[model samples]
Target: MPFDQPLPREVKVTDSASLFRLEERACDLSLNSRLDPAWVRANAALDGAHYLWPALWNSLAHRPEVPRQLRCELLITLRAGDRVVSWLDVLPADFNPLPRVTSREEGMQVSQLLDRAPSVREWLLREGGGSGQQ
Candidate 1:
């Protein structure tokens, strides 16, 4: 669907995790919406085999001014399969470290988390998985 296409509802942003709520107010516009969960899961079977996957996504996300590719990948991965009983908690890239809170006022945990790139990457791997594609 086009980013301009309106959804049935919007998910409220009471918390960053709400980013994945997919309710009317919850989602941000995404250019790579074509890369949906079903597609990713279907293609994950070809992850490493796709010679230009990351580069292709980077071009779309960075060069073309689309949504962040890594973020999109993470989001899609979170929604894939997930036939398990537990809910797939899609963490807003903004929140991190135990007991942390994110908000415009009085919340400064963000800077520290950003500074620790390794931890962030590890989190991505742990959550998104080392080879998540489909």
Candidate 2:
């Protein structure tokens, strides 16, 4: 996928085990990085439908170390049952899912955090325009 392309909105994982594996891989990659995998696992119940959206990929495009597959990928949101559990930026090549935030409150917090990054804020605002939310 190219950096200009957008990812699918949602990815359903019927198997909890598969989700676990993905999470484990993400967690392992996350270690020694900006995100704390243990804290993410402890806070969020990552076992349900996975939502995806393009994250701050453009910011990482200049880095040769980041894989192309991951550079144009989407961020993952784990939902356990009906509740939104966690948000992760999965980086398999480098450091894994950099856990962003959890819960509704944290979601808002992350939004604020994203706003601090100009590129991300612009991308989000542009992408969010036709989301059908009034």
Q: How do all models score by TM-score?
A: 0.24, 0.35
Largest lDDT belongs to which candidate? Answer: 2
Poorest 10 consecutive residues by lDDT, candidate 2: 71-80
Q: Write the per-residue lDDT of candidate 2 for residues 1-134, one digit (tens) a residue.
A: 45685543223232334344545665554421122334334423455333333344433445566444332222223332222323344453422343323466755543443334233224336546221111
Best by TM-score: 2
TM-score: model 2 vs. ground truth: 0.35
Ten-residue segment with the worst summed lDDT in candidate 1? 47-56
The residue pairs that clash in candidate 2, if any, are 29-96
